[model samples]
Target: MFDVVVCKKKQEAENIYSFELTLPEQGYLPKFQAGAHIDVEVRPGLIRQYSLCNPAGKTDRYLIAVLNDPASRGGSVGMIEQVLEGQTIRISKPRNLFPLDENTGFTLLLAGGVGITPIIAMAEQLQQLGRDFELHYCGRSRTSMAFIDRLRHSPFAAKVILHCDDGDAKQKLNLDTVFGATPEDSHLYICGPAGFMDYVLGQATDSGWPEARLHREYFSAPDVASADTAGDEEAESFTLRLARSGKELKVAADQSVANVLLDNGIEIPISCEQGICGTCLTSVLEGIPDHRDYFMTAKEHALNNQFTPCCSRSKSSVLVIDL
Candidate 1:
């Protein structure tokens, strides 16, 4: 974790806050492509991933935004509500898991609430490169949206569609019509709340859009949102073995495998801690992981038994994790 001072702050919405951090300019700040996010060290041993909303041009510092979710785990609440203006926080170098495809002809961008962060970054990049793309941003209300002014002022501003449920009677995001009418070569990107994301993805899949063409990002482990999903309703028992430590940990019916690993002092690089970012991805030598993350490429999980440790569980009794 690197120390970065909060250079500036702004309130984008009622609880949506933006922060610009000042990092040392001497060394190279990791060069991140569009759609990258950085993990900020809030307090000792606590890190949260915020998407880089700034466009690429200068290599000065990183700009991030955080929305205070009242129902969220304390991490986001602390970052947004409790963090002082000038204080510094440890930050991980930028990582790009949601990179734009180089050959994208025309892209469809969908964002719900704060999920607009990275999608806005992609719009900035697309504007610079003169790419053909359309962005659909859905929010609870106009007053609740972040970065709306910046987006409206962009050169490619006409390409953006902002949907506010409170103001518009036709408030819902019509993902099916959006995907159905889009060009065959179009690639789709989505980010947002779990219900919004699931609806968009499920509709897209049900509409017959190719899986490769649809992409999405999550801020937490999928199971957290999908706890009521099929199979998750019933807790199952499993055992995990740490290869390096030669210790076996039992997963209780009530606890996730991640909590068990953490209780044992295993250093798994986790950002979302909910299996959203693939940072805590662990190698699966055995057992079928109940893959519950948006991180995996269909081929990557099936071709090799890879799983995100943050939200996955084992179907087999003995699951060995390579930390």
Candidate 2:
């Protein structure tokens, strides 16, 4: 667990707060490139990952912004209600899964609502490095979007297009021009809500853009009543033997495999039990894991035989869990 002091807080929108936290006068802090996020322990057992939006200029501080999602089942609501100025918090070192690769070709970035957090950092980095990129930020209106002030002054400000949905007279941007018959050197990046991401991805696919040229990240996990997931999900039940406990647990089709293992007193590291994180990753010795999470590639799931049980189930009847 790493410690951070809340150095500053600013309200970016009605319910959104941008927080700047700094390390102690300790010799040096872990340096993080753009598109990195830190897992903050907001409560006794709950930890949430928030992206670092500030540039690498501040060696002493890390920046994060939080939106109070009244509909959020977890941290957002609590972080909005509970946190105060000058509070101390524990955070994990930064981890980057969404990173900017070296390229001279024009880059297209799409951000939907609060998903702009990480992409904002990438844009700032690109601007400093004098890279060619364009960002499309979509929101209901300017009132709900964060960082309007900073984004306006970005070196790539002219390239930043704002698409406001609340009767902006005209749509500020369109994805068809960005993806349809795009150049071979063009690379696209997106981060947004599920519906928005799905639509953009579908359009890109229809445009015949190579899957390798398109990249996206979902802000929320897919376990929340998704139509893509099956209702009559599991066909058969199975037994999972924990390597740590040397005990077997029965899992029913109605229950998640992770729950049964946890009920049997075997602890598997988990965050975002919704299957967004790879924290619960475990090796499967004998059975096929019905892969569900977005973190693992198809090849990784097949070749590595590792599973994320929080949302994954066993396809085989009897499997040995490495725990």
Candidate 3:
């Protein structure tokens, strides 16, 4: 289900714009956690998920920031250019796979570029609860950083660190210094571009940060050049058995399950067909799956009971799926 709302634009920084959304009829919206995101319907068939940046547990109005990217697939373009203030749009309910765990000894919030949206919200919540936390916000330039003014004036400004590459090189974010001295019971959260995420996560791992202590959410899928090459190999025909329907369908390696299903008159709800979103996730009744999605954690992969058909394939010759 979707809720129709009227949005008013609030400029945050440079090309970054925050929209305060309220129901067209004006009433309390659904309550959401710090890391929750809502899927906004930008156009007839185009939808994009954006993190709710407002304080956690706040139901007054949902706030989302969007950076005007010319390279976007019409979602950001539509929101920044087409959807003006006072215009109405539809958005999905909040969904959160990334959330804050308050039981940690300390919290490290690392954000790159527009990734600050969710991390900022997490910082605000942590501050309100009087928790031990620090936020490191990085951008190419000070002018490019969003919410800079707001954070500077906030009561928690002392807990915030700003790093800009255009500034002094020594002042830039030093992953080694940050991760090297991390407490054993601390939890780290990161969000950013593929390269930025890789660098932070790779160094954190080298610093002995356990898998359980590290959490990340990607606005885009990690750069998988090798995976793309492997996925494009010559077609290897396989069978897809629908456990519920007792039907079997042939799936060519060159064709994704979603495409094959669509051709066979079987429709499945899907978004971010690149496997970044979990909208097309389906249960695996039998057989092993080649997990190609970034939506699931390592623990979920170990269960082997679900897979995203939009991009993931079968490891076995046949995959029995619960359709």
Candidate 4:
């Protein structure tokens, strides 16, 4: 972890603010790639991940934007209400779960609302590399969109298309037009609300776009029924075996594996307990995991070698994990 000072805080859009963080000495920090995010210690025991919105190669400062979400579980609220300019905060090194595939022949970038944070970095990287790419930014309205003027005056302005729900029908996003035909070597990267992402993913799938070519990052996990409400078949108690210590623990139906381990004095670093973040991802030594996380792709889940313990449980009666 590093202590970075919040150099500036500016309101970007309606309830959205961008923070510029820099080292105390104003020196270069660790280099990060596009789609990389840092874990900010919002408050004691409250760490939240925010995407790096600044250019990847620029190490002088790191930029992140946070939307004061109504449904936020304290992350955004704390950032907007408590954090102030010139305040020093603790943050983890950059981690990239949503990496950009620069080798693709063509790239399609899609952003909705605050999701534009990572998409902007991707566009900057693509422009720097002289890669062929187009960006489509969608929002509820012009006033609700962040960095509109910046994008409009950017060097790659011509490659960008704006879509507003409250604007003219012609300016609204048409998935059919955005995705006419799937190019063999083209890749699509999407980051947005769960509903927006689901709609885009569904449309892309229906348009014959292979899952391999479609990438996405979700700010929060979609609402899903809990284990208790999943019927007795899925809510059965399970046993967990720690590989290194050879210790065993019982995971009750009403409890999560993370809580069970924590109660036993076994610490597993966890950020987003909802499983949207991959911080608590653990390896499975022997049993299959009933993967309940949005962090890993479907193919990764099918491998059954790893799972996020924060929200995922084991399918096998006794599962061995690499603690």
**lDDT tens per residue, model 2, 89-203:** 8888888777776474777888888878888888888888888888889888889889988999877789888888885556655776656544667777888777787788788
TM-score of every candidate: 0.90, 0.88, 0.93, 0.96
lDDT of 3 by residue, 62-101 (tens): 9999988766778788888888888878888898878899
Model 2: lDDT to the true structure: 0.76
**Per-candidate total of colliding backbone pairs:** 1, 0, 0, 0
- Evaluated at residue 13, the lDDT of candidate 3 is 78
Better model by TM-score: candidate 1 vs candidate 2: 1
- lDDT digits (tens) for residues 55-174 of candidate 4: 999999999999999999999999999999999999999999999999989999999999999999999999999999999999999999999998999999999999999999999999
Candidate 2, residue 180: CA error in Å? 3.8
Q: Which candidate leads the pack in lDDT?
A: 4
Q: For candidate 3, which ten residues in a row score worst on lDDT?
A: 223-232
> Please, what are the lDDT tens digits per residue for candidate 1 over residues 271-318?
676667888888877677777666776667675577877677777788
Per-model lDDT: 0.80, 0.76, 0.85, 0.92
User: All predictions: root-mean-square deviation over Cα?
Assistant: 2.6, 2.7, 1.9, 1.9
Over all chains combined, what TM-score does candidate 1 have?
0.90
Question: Which residue pairs of candidate 1 clash?
Answer: 221-274
Which candidate would rank higher by TM-score, 2 or 4? 4
Order candidates by lDDT, high to low.
4, 3, 1, 2
Error of 2 at 42 (Å): 0.9
Clash-forming residue pairs, model 2: none
